[model samples]
Target: MVHRKHNRVDGKGRIVIPVKIRQAMGIEPGSMIEFDYMARRHQLVIRAVTETDQRAHNRET
Candidate 1:
C-alpha cells in the first residue's frame, strides 16, 4: 500500500491533486470523479467514475 500525506481544503472547499497520483490513476483535467463512504466501516474511497460506467454489468430484475 502506498502512503500519501495531503492537506485539507481551503475555505473555498478546493483541494489540489498531486501530479504523481493523477498520472498513476490516469486522471486528466475535467475527468469525472466520485466519492463513496461506508458509514458502518468509517471508510471513504475516491474513484474515477460513476455508476453510469456499470450499465452493461447490471443484472435483469
Candidate 2:
C-alpha cells in the first residue's frame, strides 16, 4: 500500500516532510534527504539516509 501525507510548498518552494514520515523513516533533525526523479514517468522518489546508506557513501568517498 502507498502511504501518503499532504504538505504544500511555500513561496520559496519548500515542502515539509510530515512528522509521521520522518519518524517512520527514522529521520532525525539534520538528517539528509535524497531524491530521484523519473522524467519519463514524472515521479519523484524520496528516501531518508540510513546508516547503511551512510556507510556505502563513505566508502565511495
Clashes of 2: 0
Q: Show where candidate 1 strays beyond 4 Å.
A: 1-3, 50-61
lDDT of 1 at 58: 55
TM-score of each model, in listed order: 0.66, 0.80
- In Å, residue 27's CA in model 2 sits off its true spot by 0.9
State each candidate's clash count.
Answer: 0, 0
Kindly give the stretch of ten consecutive residues in candidate 1 with the minimal lDDT sum. 52-61
lDDT of each: 0.73, 0.85
Q: 22, model 2: CA deviation in Å?
A: 0.8
State the lDDT of candidate 1 residue by residue for 1-61, as single tens digits.
4748587999998887788777777779877777799999999787776356545335432
Query: Which one is best on lDDT?
Result: 2
Candidate 2 lDDT, tens digit per residue, 1-61?
Answer: 3559877889998898877777888789988889999999999898988878889999999
Best by TM-score: 2
lDDT of 1 at 24: 71
Error of 2 at 9 (Å): 1.0
lDDT of 2 at 27: 81
